[model samples]
Target: MTNLLHAMLGKGLGGLEQVFLDYQPILEAWAAKRGGRCVGVVRNGGKVAAAQAGRTPPLIPMPAFTDWDPITLGAARAVVRANRPAIILSHGQRPARVFAKAAPAGVIQAVCVHKPSFDVTPGTHYLCVGQHLANLALERGAAADHVHVVQNAVRPPPVQAQPFAREDGPVKIVAAGRLHAKKGFDVLIRAVGKLRAWDVDVTCEIAGEGAERADLEALIKTLDLDPCVKLVGWTDDIAGFLATGDLFAFPSHQEGFPLTLLEAMAVGLPVVATEIDGPVEILDEGVTGRLVPDDDPDRLAEALGELISDRDTAQRLGAAARELVLTEYGPDELARRLEAALDGMLVNSKA
Candidate 1:
């Protein structure tokens, strides 16, 4: 039953880092109890230096991907040589490719498909974050029997009621994600602009940081929404931040499975997200959240406005959302599911 979960970091920043970082502590403690080990490989910054500084176990870090040298197969082979882990679980596309090559014959390899990427390798099993991603992986050549859907989970902060009174006032709308083009924040800004024509008193707060910050800010000003829109950068605490808003909006063009929607639901906020794959799978249109056409700010805005204008309905929906998350997305339950999946893979491989 000896095992190790190898989490590799590609870029020094972004949602992937945030996600893998959150799980490191949990996996480390859990592995120690089971007499196994889990290691994180951060490829940038003071990762290697920092790991050595503390009494914590060592993790591998390599040079950044370059034109001449892609992710080296040798490095992956060396890691497996050192750990001698019975199973390898690689997160993200590139890691999967490297692990597929590096893993010894008979070692189980589970690759996580976070988004659309050209990283699929032959004879590799997949752990998709959402149903859409599971389907995408199979369609893109991953064996159907080798793939499983395992949704991401977050430890919801203590339930906090909206700070501002829930009365009918300025409709505070929120869209959260890294300020990347894939997030479709510009589309959200445009939708907000269109909503203004209807004299809807709305203010949108885009919370996150990325390359698209300047562009989105400029769009807000150009659309005469400088007063109505604000781009708040990344925050350590999301539930508390979202508690100040009335509705949560996500217009991402693509996703593995966004924890943002679930976080919002846990905090009892009614959602108005794009009817994209991830959101559609989590939200039932008239139930936990409203699903609108992707990139269509018109529908997004209309849905946001509808939720804001009706307080009783909004409260009812919010209550339902919170209940749903508690019942279905608990962190402990999710961890158990992951452990079971890994155990199944281990047992089936031996058979």
Candidate 2:
């Protein structure tokens, strides 16, 4: 069987880390189908290691990786020598930086690009998490054939997304992601302030913790949205948290296939998102979900207000969105595409 290593020797949890952990076992299973096996490489006793605990194919936990450090370099080289994997799939920046050097003679090195700066070396292949990412990889000196579009995806929630239900009270709008300026949560808060003028009563809860938390709080006060807009910090239970809300709102300034957006869709919440790359690709206007111009609070507010007032249209869009995510971006489809990409890399390496 061909040996493969899925390396992400980084700290903390985010979209990149979460996708690696969730996709590891699926990648392993996919490899197994073709007479191969995939193993994880993570930081010893770190968040990634803990999350990937007790899964099949095991893992190789080493001290944190430093690209230029001789000790770290030697350790990486030693792992490559000992494992002698046919393919080394490194996730994000750190592993990408080192694996290009660590992977010796025969191993086919591939990097899973979660965002733009996560580049691979000339000969290495890239499994970009989004189509635009693949395009960017090509633009930034990667070989045309070396880039593959595997796309980002989310595993099916334990329970299906509950149906849209609002017996009383205002329409509940929910958003989840890092509270960064890039997420455009401030614009969402501004939009919440404008919803008042449309005579649409709504309560907005933005989940996740980031550096912008304090700034967002201040903005809420400035908008006089103290009663309706609240930045509810990060939570692990995104599915459960989303189930309680009436609508999902994503005002991200940029995204390379957001998994949380897919998660929100999978759970059947009518969504209104900014016209960013990922959202634009997946959401069809007035179909799956509503889309407003990015970084524009007035447009965001208008779209949110329109959906809130029309319950029938909101429910239709929610159901369609749920179907789109599950059918096109679910774990099963992700695995099939990932396997195909890896298979292509293996063939090219032989050639």
Candidate 3:
């Protein structure tokens, strides 16, 4: 049975971390069914442990950023020796660098690229989270055959007896992610302001906390969107939150296959997202959801207005989005693809 180690530079509960938490158990179960094993390795004292909540194969916490430090490297190498993993799948750049040096000979090393900026080390296979990221990896000198595009997946939410959002009440719009500039929460807030000015009865709830919380709060106040826009901090119940919203607005300036967007789609929320790499790949312009230009509040406002004004269109798009995810990006399908990739890597290592 092949033992696999999934390693990551654990920091916060962002999309990357979420991907690790969501897929770790599924991958572990898949491995177990095949008479193999999957284990997780993350930086010591990071939030990843809390997110895992006692799930397994098991999680091994090690020092982060210890790229060639003899002592830490020795410790990591010892873990590798003890586990004897045939495949080491590193989540981000830092973890990739650390594992590349620590993994013993014969162990296949693969890096999962979850963002635009990544290190394309020679001889390491890359699992790009989106097609756009895969293209970027190829441009950065990664071997074309070594890079694989793996779309993020989510389980469809339990069917609700009744639709969550009220068609008669003020439309509830939800957007989630780290409160950072890259997320473009400011652009979303401005869009909400414009909608409010046009007398559209809509309330926007920005979930998840980060460094940009104060600035976002200040912008909300400046725009006189005190009651219309609320910055709700980090939420563990993302599915429940999305269930209550009429629409999902993702105005991110950058992304690498955002799990929340998939989650939103799974719950049948019509999405209005920025026309960036990840969103462009996910949303089919007006089919699954509406796409707006990145960082453009006016265009964002226009898109939001279109969905808010047309409930029928919103419901149709949301349903289409849900079907798209269920059919193409389900957890089981993604897990199978991952298993195939791991198998391919093992064979390549032998070659």
Q: What tens-digit string does per-residue lDDT give for candidate 2 at 1-351?
A: 788888888777888788887778877886677687777888877887887687565678877646888877877888888877888888877887777778877778888887766654788899988888898888889998799998888767665544446577788899999988999999999998999766788899999999999999999998899999988888989998887788999999888889889999988999999898888878999999999998999999888888877888998999999888889988789888988898899889878
Candidate lDDT (C-alpha), each: 0.74, 0.84, 0.83
Return the lDDT, model 1, position 30: 60
lDDT of 3: 0.83
On TM-score, the candidate that comes out on top is: 2
User: C-alpha displacement of 82 in model 3, angstroms?
Assistant: 0.7
Q: What lDDT is reached at residue 277 by model 2?
A: 83
Candidate no. 3 TM-score: 0.94
TM, every model: 0.89, 0.94, 0.94
> Model 1: how far is 109 from its true place, Å?
1.5
Per-residue lDDT, model 3, residue 106, is 67
Taking the tens digit of each residue's C-alpha lDDT, what string does model 3 give over 1-351? 877888877778677887787668866876687677888887777888665657545588777756877866876788888878878888887777777788877678898888888877788899988999999889999887788888888877775212335548788889888888899999999988988888988899988988999999999999999988998888878888888888899999889888889889988888999888988888898899999888899998888888877878988899999989899889887887787777677777777
Candidate 2 TM-score over all chains jointly: 0.94
Q: Which of candidates 2 and 3 is the stronger one according to lDDT? A: 2
Instruction: Evaluate residue 193 in candidate 1 and report its C-alpha lDDT on the 0 to 100 scale.
Output: 92
